[model samples]
Target: DWVNLEAHELNIPKDESTKNEAHWNCTLKNRTVKVLRRWLNERATYDKYQDRDELWLTKKATPYSSKSCNYLLTRLIEEGDVPIPEHKEITWYSIRHGVATHWANHVGPHHAKEQLRHKSVTTTMKYLHSDSEMRSTAVEQIW
Candidate 1:
């Protein structure tokens, strides 16, 4: 829980809708932990619901729903002056897919599957995609 503040990991509670039947622990990157700690400190100064397990809250003092979270991400992307391609839209799941693709390409599908916490590697393969560089390298090696 956010209230406990573990040094290097965050506990994710299970959600049946997402197929997560048991709680899982995600180890954080060093930079992520630092950033989260700083945010928690700042959040503590203003958030009235300090006793709540949620790490984030809305202006109305409620936990953010997934839709609201995505809206906030879009707003942040816009406010940060990030450009979006003509026919593409970025959402939270797309960002996750990008990460999964990166891991699958650079590390391996098995490692990517473990990182994604998927019960089966088949599901992880859906996010794995071959980029131009990888395709070029494969052709070179085959020739």
Candidate 2:
């Protein structure tokens, strides 16, 4: 299992209601590992800056404002060569919602809450939608 140890090592405060730092472990496929290693190697080729602040100021690395990130994503969708299905309304936040929902469906509520770093379980639950099929299945399990 490939663990993203970075999140676990983050010295953030945790409360009963919220987890500030979240991590996920996955079985790393060879191709994905190779790709990640390549990216890290490429990044290492550049001279190290004194600190994160200096790097941000001196290099092309700038903080991504939420609005700017969303705008850039939309532009990429519109102009990029990749074929994507037409959607009437789509926003960058939807991707986060989708990931939360998917995790909730596969791993159950408790795990999903931890993974998402949600302040409240209620907020995590909001991502999970109840459909008629799921309701029926849940009812059957109770009997």
lDDT of 1 by residue, 19-134 (tens): 67676666687888888889888877874767776677898888788788889989998999998998888887788898889989988988888778888899999987778998
List the global CA lDDT of all models: 0.80, 0.59
What alpha-carbon RMSD in Å does predicted model 1 have with respect to the real structure? 2.6
**Candidate 1 Cα lDDT to native:** 0.80
lDDT of 1 at 81: 92
Per-prediction TM-score to the true structure, in the order listed = 0.81, 0.55
- Model 2, stretches more than 4 Å misplaced? 1-34, 47-50, 53-59, 80-88, 130-143
The residue-by-residue lDDT of candidate 2 on 1-143, one tens digit each, is 13233332222333322335444333344665666667555655665533332212223466555676677778887788556666644567777677777777777877777666776879988887655776799899997
lDDT of 2: 0.59
